[model samples]
Target: MVKYNLEPSESILIQSTGVCEGSGLMTAFTDELILTNMNIIHVSKGLFGNTKSVRKYPLNQVKIINGEAQASMGKSTNGIPNLQIYFTNGQLSFKFQSSAKKEIVKYVNGISKVLIGRESNLVANQFAIPGAEIVAETLKDTIGVFKGTLGIKSKGKAADEPVKATKKCIGCMSPLTGTKGQSIRCSYCDTDQIL
Candidate 1:
């Protein structure tokens, strides 16, 4: 088992003990997957392949995780399990053989449980947390504060009077926080203002 440097509240839910390899993009690396409440950690070697290192994927940013069987009909004894994890940055596909089917099932179940719990928490927090993003969007008409802070201002009866509060992100329709000279980038969908 590859030892992982866990964070303060991070606790291991499952660990892939034996031979398991992860391959994606231009990289084929062997690492033990450690699933925690907060992250999915890959314990492997660093740049020189000598020192041990870890790559962590936060649970919130994960798009999806899927596991499917790759077993053949004739080979009844031996089963294969392929696990795929999708994230905002990238995704990884892992093919596990030998005694991996059982281990992969364990990992899938553990991750499902954690994800369900997080979803419920998010739903509950939706009502509790104040919407700070909404308030920031409504400040377009009132630019005096920004002018004073940035030391830039125009004469009385300013020509531009577009309400920033009314401006919504083109992708997600969420409210946007825009500066006068700077282009607005949507925080929700990560869309850059490119014309």
Candidate 2:
């Protein structure tokens, strides 16, 4: 059995043993592939079984290619389907038992779902407007200042008195209430507000 450490939130989703075709001396060796929620672990044991090497690939960076068609094509020369996992730097091909085709397909589907969901979330977050609440508050405050300057009474408050100028804290961007040309310190971030 292969020994590996799983993370706190990681668990084995599926596993299978197959002959792995990797680069360099790691080629054509039978290794155990353990699929976890966060990563795919490849465990290869040395000839003596005393030495072993483990490699981990993040699930987000893994891509399953031509997995579904393997069932019909049987592309390998030995009449077996090869499960190809593509990474950013290289690729790994594994030849598993023909009976495990269903499990492999299921694994591919799960990976597809994860990748799609991750991509959508990234897009959503990337285009999201930052500091929207701050912008809205600033707009409201600007409108109030304009009203006070025009001597427009708001909510039964008298606008006859001079309105104190407001500036934003340099560090925290919080509104600072003070007179023009006065220096104030922000209570939130302790930043000096120079107006």
Candidate 3:
């Protein structure tokens, strides 16, 4: 088993190609250090609440048993082997022990920033989301993994406005945050429509 230790002052991104079982985008997070078995379908499929329609693969659950991450990603009776996820101290790490030569990058606070331009080469077209791409590149050039801490970068400036629902005129997507008191003016789209 190959393990990469990460800390608060650093971040690691690994090629998630074979890490997740299903086809759509797959990303996982944990605190750090402690391994957690994951049920790949548990996120979208309702194991706790309600079950949705089954898709291409009907995986129900996964668990880490004695150094192996077993997953049921298909109709097979036997579980497939995969890496276990480590979580502790608000930090998350991934372990991969496969023949696939996919890369994982580790980054620390002052030492490096994920080069977005470099990620353009690694992940497939569909896997390229805003945050996922950043993680992928960071793991590519991980000089060393830090322990007991995690390094995080602020993505963007936080907006002061609290996110509230706006009742649009059912036509245009406009702000109606203050439309409750007055039916006189929309001041938004200028539409006289009332919710």
> TM-scores across all candidates?
0.43, 0.45, 0.15
Writing each residue's lDDT as its tens digit, candidate 3 over 11-85 gives 333222223222222332211211211111111223233323322111112222343223111211223222222
| lDDT assessment of candidate 1 | 0.57
- The clash count for each model shown is 0, 0, 18
166: Cα error in model 3, Å: 90
- Using lDDT as the measure, the top candidate is 2
Candidate closer to the true structure by TM-score (higher is better), 1 or 3: 1
What CA root-mean-square deviation does each model show from the true structure? 20.9, 16.3, 22.9
Writing each residue's lDDT as its tens digit, candidate 2 over 1-195 gives 586789999888777765454333335445677778788787876655543678898876764344321111123555455556667666666655445455455555555555554222322333359988789999989999999899976764554444578877789888889766677889999887667
Give the worst 10-residue stretch by lDDT in candidate 1. Answer: 68-77
Arranged by TM-score with the best first, the candidates are 2, 1, 3
Error of 1 at 21 (Å): 3.8
Better of 2 and 3 by lDDT: 2
**Where is model 3 more than 4 Å wrong at Cα?**
1-8, 21-79, 85-195
